[model samples]
Target chain A: MENPPVTDFATDWDHTDPAWVHDPYPIWDDLRQRCPVAHTDRYGGAWFPATHAGVSAVAQDTEHFTSRTVVLGNGRPLEDAPPAPIGVAPPITSDPPFHTIARRLILPAFAPGPVRALEPRVRELCRRLLDDLGDATEFDAATQYAQFIPPGVIVRMLGFPEADEDMFRDFIHVVLEGVNHPVEERIEEFAPIEAYITAQIEDHRAHPRDDLTSYLLGVEVGGQPLAPEHVFGTIILVLIAGIDTTWSAIGSALWHLASHPDDLARLREDPDLMPIAIEEFLRFYAPVTMARLVKRDVEFLGCPMREDDWVLLGFPAANRDPAVFPDADRFVIDRLENRHLAFGLGIHRCAGSNLARMEMRVALEEFLARYPHVELTDPEAVTWSQGQVRGPRRLPVRVASA
Target chain B: MKVTIDAARCQGHGRCFNLAPDVFGFDELGNGVVLVASPPDDRAERLARLAQVNCPEHAIDIEE
Candidate 1:
C-alpha cells in the first residue's frame, strides 16, 4: 500500500511520504510559512495544521472534530467503524461526556502519586536493559535499549507475561504503521491482535490480579462493570498509546544526545538538567501526530473541511512554531518559559504523561550513568519510523569510553 | 502577587506543581492547585510566574 510521492505537501500532504518520514520539521516549517493548514485529498481529504494556533484551535474545538480515529487510514469510521463518542479505543478515541467518564476511570492509575511510585521499578528496568548491552562499544540504542523500556513497563502494568513483549510490539506495528493498508487487509491484520487481547481478558478474569487489566475488569462504571467493548478498547489503548509513544520519545531523545555531543556532555555534566533537557527533547522531537475526523462540514482555519475529513493534529509541529516559545526551533536545555504541547493540550492531554516522563528520565539517567560518553556511530545510517509516532528505528551509537 | 489555577482549563499537565512545588500542588486527580495564594516573597513570586507561563493550558493566572 505505497502512497505516491507527494509533489507539494501544502496542497497534497501525505504523512507517510518518504520525505515527511525522513525529516518533517522542514516540511512543517515550509507549510507554516505558506499555509498554516495544509489540505490533502489523500485519506478522503485530510487537513494538517502546521501552526500552534491552528493546532490549538482544532484540539480544543472538540465540537467540530471527533476523536473517532486518532490514526488516519483509508477506512473512515463513519463507514464501517464503531459509532462515535465511543470509538475503537476508549478515551483516546471517545469524544465529549463519554470521553470524560472513560478518561477518569483510568486516570488514577497514571496519576502523579502512583506514577512516581513506579520510578524505582522503572529505574531497575532501565538498569537491566542497559546491563544487557554489556561492554559493547557500538550498539543500536533504539532497538537494544529504548524499544524495550515501554513494553517492559506496560506488561508489568497490564499483568501480561514478559515473554509476550515481541507479540505486543508486532501488534503495535500493525496498528500504528499499517495506516496505508486497504480496509480489508487492515481487518485481517487485526485478527491476531483481537484474538490476543481476547485471550488476555480471559486470563485476567480467571486469575484476577492487582494489575491494571484485573483492575479494569473489576472497576464499575455508574452501577455496573464497563461494557466488554470498553474493557477491551481501553486495554488496546494502553498497549498502543503507552508503548511506542514513550519509546519514540526516549529513542529520539537518545538520538539527539548521540548526535549532539555538547548537549550530551552538558546533560551528563549537570545532572540537574535532565528534567529540563527531557522537556526540550519532547518538544524538539515530539513523536505523536494525532488525527481527528471532522464532525461535519465546517470552515476551520480558513479551510473547508468536509464531514469525516481527517485533521492531522501536529503537536510536534506546534512545539516548533515561533509564535509560542522564543527561539522555538532551538533546543534550549534550561528553557523555563516553555508551554510546549508535546503531550498535547485541552481535555485530551495524554493520560500516561506522568508515566512517560518518569520512564524517559529514568531511561536517560540509567543509560548515561552506565556509559558516560555516547556518539552516533553513523549519523547517515539513522532511520526514523513512519506514520504518526516518529523516532529512530535504527539508532546505531558508539558508547566507547574515551 | 497572587496566583490561581483555572480548574476548568487545568487538565493536570502539572507544570505548576513541577516548577514551583512550594507555591503549587496537585489534587488526587493531579490537576494543579494554588498552594500559596499570595507569594510569600520575591523568589516565590518569580517561580509562580514561571509556572504560569509554562502552563500549556494557560490555566495559571497571576495577579500583581
Candidate 2:
C-alpha cells in the first residue's frame, strides 16, 4: 500500500494555554483536514487520528489495537502501585478472556434495572442542586450541577463510605492532575490516592457490605480473589470514568444548550426530543479523548502504525467527521441514524454508557423544566479543562425569573 | 426465537438489560438470562432484538 504523506508529528500541545482548553475543536478540525493521521512525539511517542473514521477504526479493531498494562502511565504498573489488586488490569485495561471475566463480575451491579431505579434519585439530586442556585442570575454549572451529580451517584453505586466522598473527589482531581503533571510531581500526587484506596479496600474486606467494593473484594477472578491493588485500580477507573466523563458531558451539554437558545427552546417545547437530543449532544460534544496502543503493526487509512505506537482516538473529531455526520458541526437534536463513538466502540467501549446517558437525559430534562429561558452569562467567557478528559472548568449561566 | 447468554463470556456490562429489560433480566449472580423467551407482540420483539444487538458481551442471541 502506498504510504500517506508524512506530516510533521512533533507538535507540542500546550495544555496550559487557556484558549486551546476552552475549545480545541478548531485545532482538531484543522488537523483532520491537514494531517488526518499525524504523530505527536510528546508525552511519549503517540499517533493522533484526526478524522472520524481513523479514530473509530483503531478503537474498534482490538486485535490490531490492544490494551495492556503497558497503557498504564509511566508510574509503576497498577500491580505494584501500592494498592494490591485494585489498580491492576483485571478488566478495564486487559484484553480478551481476562477482560471478559472481570467485566462480567461487575455487569450485574450496573444493569439497567438498578440504573433506572436510581433515576428518581438522580433527578431529585439535580433539582436540589439547581434549587440551591435559586434565582441567582448567574452560577457556574460545573461546580453547581455537573461536578456534584456524578460523584454523588458514583459514591452511592460503589458503596464508598459517605464520609469519604471528599477524599474520593480529591483523589479524582489528583489523578487528573497527575495525567499531565511532570513525572517528578506524579509520585507525590499518586501516593495519597493509593493510600486512601488501600485503606478503603481493607475496610470493605473486614466489614463486607452489599456494595460494589465489598463484592469485588470477595469475588475471585482467574481462580483467586482479586488482589487489593486490582480492586483499587478498578475503583480508581470507575471513579475517574464515572465522575470526569459524565461531568464533562454535562458541562459541555449545558454550555451548548445555554449558548443555543433555539435548540434549548426546541427541547423545552417538546420534551419527546430530549432522548435523541441527548445522543446528539454526546456526539457533537464527545467528552473523552482516548488513546489506544497499536498491538501490532497495521495500516489504517493508508497510514502505517507499528507495535507500541500510541493511537490517540479523538472522539470529538470522529463525532464531528463531516463524512459520517452530515452538517457535522451543526447540532441537530433530531438528527436521525446518528451512531457516535462518544462512548467508544467494540469491547473496550464504555461500560457505564447507559448510566452516563441517563445522567445526561435527567439533568437536561430537569434543567430545561426548571429554567426555560436560561442563557450563558457570557458565552465567550466559559472555559473548559484540558488533558485527555475534556470539559468546561466553569459554565456560567443566568436563568430568567419565572 | 431463542435467547442465550454465555454466562462465562458475559462480563455483565448490563447494556442488554438496560436496553430491553422486559425481554432480558439478570440472575442473582448478576449474570444475564432471558426474562421472556417469546414476546407477546412485535413491539416486544423489536425491543428484544435491540437488547440482543446492544449486548456488549454478544451474550444475547435471538434465533429466529
Candidate No. with top DockQ: 1
RMSD of each: 1.2, 5.3
> Model 2: how far is A189 from its true place, Å?
0.3
For model 2, residues A138-221, the per-residue Cα lDDT tens digits are: 888887888888988998877876666667667776666456565567667778877777887888888898888888888975
Give the poorly placed runs of model 2, Cα more than 4 Å off.
Answer: A1-20, A69-90, A296-301, B1-64
> Candidate 2, A219: how far from true, in Å?
1.6
CA lDDT of B30 in candidate 2? 48
Q: Say which docking band candidate 2 falls in.
A: incorrect
How accurate locally, in lDDT, is each candidate?
A: 0.90, 0.72
Q: Give the Å error, residue A304, model 2.
A: 3.9
What TM-score quantifies how close candidate 2 is to the native fold? 0.83
